[model samples]
Target: MSSGPRDDDVLRWYVGVPIGTNPLILMDFATVLVLVWAFAITAVVLLQLFFGHSLTGEHIQAAARLATRLVLLAAAGFAIISFLLLRNRYTALYRLDREGLYCENMRMGWGEGGLGELSKSFHWRPFAVPPLRDPAKSVTKKVPWRLVDKVLPLEGTRTLLFKSGRGTAARVYCPDDGTFERALRFARAHIPEDARSGPEKELQQS
Candidate 1:
């Protein structure tokens, strides 16, 4: 029902997440690439077995060669696509207040030189790469304190995961240790006592 938080009502900051910097982001891309490669190889093998007379050593060898080629080609394409989509470091605007948390991914522009520049060239205009989201628009999510059922901290990534009954409500990425501590303290004070996870003493020690 609420439109969004007013600027004066919250603490706001911008965080830049560059490609290959966050393991969580990298893992997501890797998972997708693996799935694509597996599906392609599976489909090919299924088709070969369906139409072939019998499973022979030669058929297996041929399938192996095809699979290898497919994996290499898929990997290359995945890397290219990932670079094109993420070349511009992702910028997220985070706003926190007594009420809840708000996160918005600002529009991004391609950087100069390399693939970014190549994609913008007139010669490649027809096949130009597009951003994952509309480059001119931002995407936002708002999570209220009342709706938050759990607060999970990931020390490795310096990220906080807020979860509701449905699933993950929102994710907050901290830029540094100090910021992470501040955010965690805020979360502890606002979220329900029962919803807190992990050792409180360990957090205090850190």
Candidate 2:
């Protein structure tokens, strides 16, 4: 919400599920546990069938081995996936300023601190594949306000669609009604006059 023109302007809002913050991430971890539990139970059931009522130490040991292996594999898979997801979320930063909207993809550098610093670096790698470095490629965009086409209100957030030929868009969660209204006002003010009139006319008629 800090709108200052300083070197470190605070982002007004964020879009994606934050690292270690969204409950959905916990649900994903729970899924891994459930899968491991199901595999262990199935293994135990199979062992019970083979051993019948005369279940012995060897049968228990076999089931234990199967369950341990399954649990280890599931945990390893979950950890790798969660690491990539959190890394991507932690590095993304989108903001709207007086001049325009901006998005930056960054990499972590020495001497940085906190989550804010983490946003400086891009960390997503599909299956841990490193991205090819391109010196000519830009990691940030500062789109002018007039180039924005529409500001659509969503449940708990808003999406701004760009009029640029590329069809780019940015989504931001509005923590409260006041913030939402302010974002809408800024978006409306920047939209072209002809583009704004059509929506207004339709609303009045309805």
Candidate 1 residues 122-172, lDDT tens each? 221011122233344578888999888777788767688888886888888
Give one digit per residue, the lDDT tens place, for model 2 in 43-141: 696769776856767877777787777777877765565445334333334566667777654443233342234552243210111222321223676
Q: Pick the candidate with the highest lDDT.
A: 1
Worst 10 contiguous positions by lDDT, candidate 2? 123-132
Q: List the residue pairs that clash in candidate 1.
A: none
lDDT of 1: 0.62
Summed over model 2, clashes come to 5
TM-score of 1: 0.65
Each model's lDDT comes to: 0.62, 0.50
Off by over 4 Å in 1: 1-9, 57-78, 81-88, 110-135, 164-167, 198-206
Q: Candidate 2, which segments miss by more than 4 Å at Cα?
A: 1-88, 91-98, 105-138, 157-166, 173-177, 200-206
